[model samples]
Target: MLNRTSLLAAPALAAALLFSAPAAQAQISTPAASPKSTVTQRVGLTDITITYSRPSLKGRQAFGTLVPFGKRWRTGANQTTSIKFSDDVTVEGKKIPAGEYGIYTIPNKTEWLVVFNKSTKQGADVDGFKDDQDVARVSVKPYKLGNKVETFTIGFSDITPATANVDMMWELTGAKFKVTSEVEPKVMAQIDEKVIKNASPSANDLAAAAVYYYDNDKDLKQALAWMQKANATDPKFWNVHTEAKIRLKMKDYKGTVASAEQSKKLALDAKNADYVKMNEDLIVEAKKTGKL
Candidate 1:
């Protein structure tokens, strides 16, 4: 009853039926190794950002062993470690313009050479690296840590209004470089344009200008004048409190005691216990200085 065509088609049809259902769909898997990380910090007037991958020690030897000595490392795992600056900055006394760069470091026993390459899009290898493409380079001393750091890390430490120290650490070794941003000129220009020349600046604007001048050790006379303007506009307790401090700095103890008394009264009415205490202490200091 089986014809030649039917006999051949029978096996083909059976095979098709036996494998008709699609194979199970593939599933996504998690990463098994280094993970990406990002850090952003505002130091002075500049915004600094770093993007890289963190690789763990995993009980393996690092530094001279895995990372190699006297050779450039990507400064992190995976793609090149990238650093971005929103404004021009000086790194380790070398000027670097505002932009993004790929960080590469050559390590040694006593020192490490930090590099900021103009190129950003690159793999961890140095196949296409050119020394002429470097934006800046500086040598930093490496220090040993007492405690072991299991994962590689980069962070900003010892931060000030105009400077920050960028620290890179892995295993028991660490290196640091300082980044400084110019802030005085920027703030001074703003002060001159916004508060000094403005005909009808608000109380808050005047107060802000006064605070900046006072904090930056600028012309205290101008600071006192601005604070006086703010106080004349509102006569608020906080405004008077700042005036008292400025007067103290100017050695006007009598003025300090007078303004501090007003601040203490207003602070009590506002139920601000902290400001009241501060004014009281300032008054005591003013009396001791024979200015009251």
Candidate 2:
């Protein structure tokens, strides 16, 4: 036996009570703690995402001190160290095609060698690293940490508009990798045309252009002309003296012999080991063919 107004007012009161109870409780409760650190970066063409817990510095010396030296490290805590590449690349003179891989490092006082393993399985140790699955391994020099670093850090340096160097430093060990963008032939051709059109030709540019055409396009006549121009412009460009060696492949022994002598003289003047060795090899080949 309630009035219609009373019934409507009761419903409104109950709804208000229900909502107010939760709001009061929420006001008194503490908020959840935030994460310590987060890492997100792009390697080459691939995207890399990482989340890790930061270690404490209380009475614990990092790197070469408390951690000791000449040991293998997980590179980071929680999850395994991971990297992703957008395109194919070479690491430490080893070929690592475009893909994702886990990164690990072995530390020493002198240098630290970084390893790119092709596994993403959690809690896997360096012993689990399979040789066939290895993408690349590079050795990098490490420097002393001047200031105390509480957290691990990785970043890039020596960044040009076109290229960059990736640096991974933590604890007592670190490594660096040089990354160069892959240039397409069409793009390179455009660059070459632009460079030639805009600037005065020099021995360096002509020699580079000649070698590129000869090696990439196999245009022998153009290569010879460019090599001749390089020799005329600056007789010091080593490749110009070596062009005759390539002509030997075309059975031009006389050209080879002449080029070898020029290469030898330049090598002697410059004191270049590789060039000197190359000259000696070419002379032997020329004499064998009765062209010397």
Candidate 3:
């Protein structure tokens, strides 16, 4: 049993509340001004990851103005930027163990000091940190960019089999530091255990070990022997091409020409012109100076 006055008051109250609500309201899903970014790259067998926020210029100067010159910066806006490494790495020849670290930087006109601090979390700033806890510090020269970069960026560049660069760029300036990992010894150990010491190695294993040795400039005689075993029967053109290269390096002109010719014939039968041309080049090189 509802009273008429109560029913009328409910409608009036609802209308008043709807009209009197604040004009400004918080959105549950709004984009951040400085959005978070993540980048990961593998140098050798190590996985390097970076997590940070990207802040845009928005008509203001970036270097020396917004991010002052020669002062330790948090490396990004909002929270501290973090870098993680899966294995021990050498940064600019200074070694740092595998773990997470906060990145701080001292930007300048010619060079920059990149710091890897042990403190990872703080109250949204890098002001409360000390240099005693730093894992590694490196000074890297800065490069000028022709075009402007509105937002801050961190990436891995100049990647090779065992090395890479941690590149940081903002506005018209860029800085980078080299990172190298100890991959050769680990790879060599694995190869020695699996292929060298094994009583019977597969064709694929032998070919792989031989190629690694050839690329690394190990004993050419051993490489040739393994390659010969791998290519003794049912040889692929690519494998034979590698054998030709090894023989050429060893200056076995006759063997080089024979292996290259065989590879050329197999390549022609397989409808691959690239290998055919490669073998022709090797044959020409071997026949040069009347060596054969």
TM-score of each: 0.88, 0.46, 0.86
Predict model 2's lDDT versus the native.
Answer: 0.65
Could you tell me the TM-score of candidate 1? 0.88
RMSD in Å for model 1: 4.4
- Candidate 1 lDDT, 141-181, residue by residue in tens: 99998898899999999999999999999999999999999
Stretches of candidate 2 off by over 4 Å are: 1-56, 65-68, 122-131, 171-174, 184-186, 189-292
TM-score of model number 3: 0.86
lDDT of 2 at 291: 46
Instruction: Name the candidate, 1 or 3, with the larger lDDT value.
Output: 1
Residue-level error in angstroms, candidate 3, position 262 = 2.1
How far in Å is the alpha carbon of 83 misplaced in model 1? 0.8
The best candidate in terms of lDDT: 1
Question: Residue 23 in candidate 3 has what lDDT?
Answer: 38
Deviation of model 3 at 256, angstroms: 1.2
The superposed Cα distance between candidate 1 and the true structure at residue 148, in angstroms, equals 1.8
Candidate 3: worst 10 consecutive residues by lDDT? Answer: 120-129
Ranking by lDDT: 1, 3, 2
- When 1 and 3 are scored with TM-score, the better candidate is 1
Best by TM-score: 1
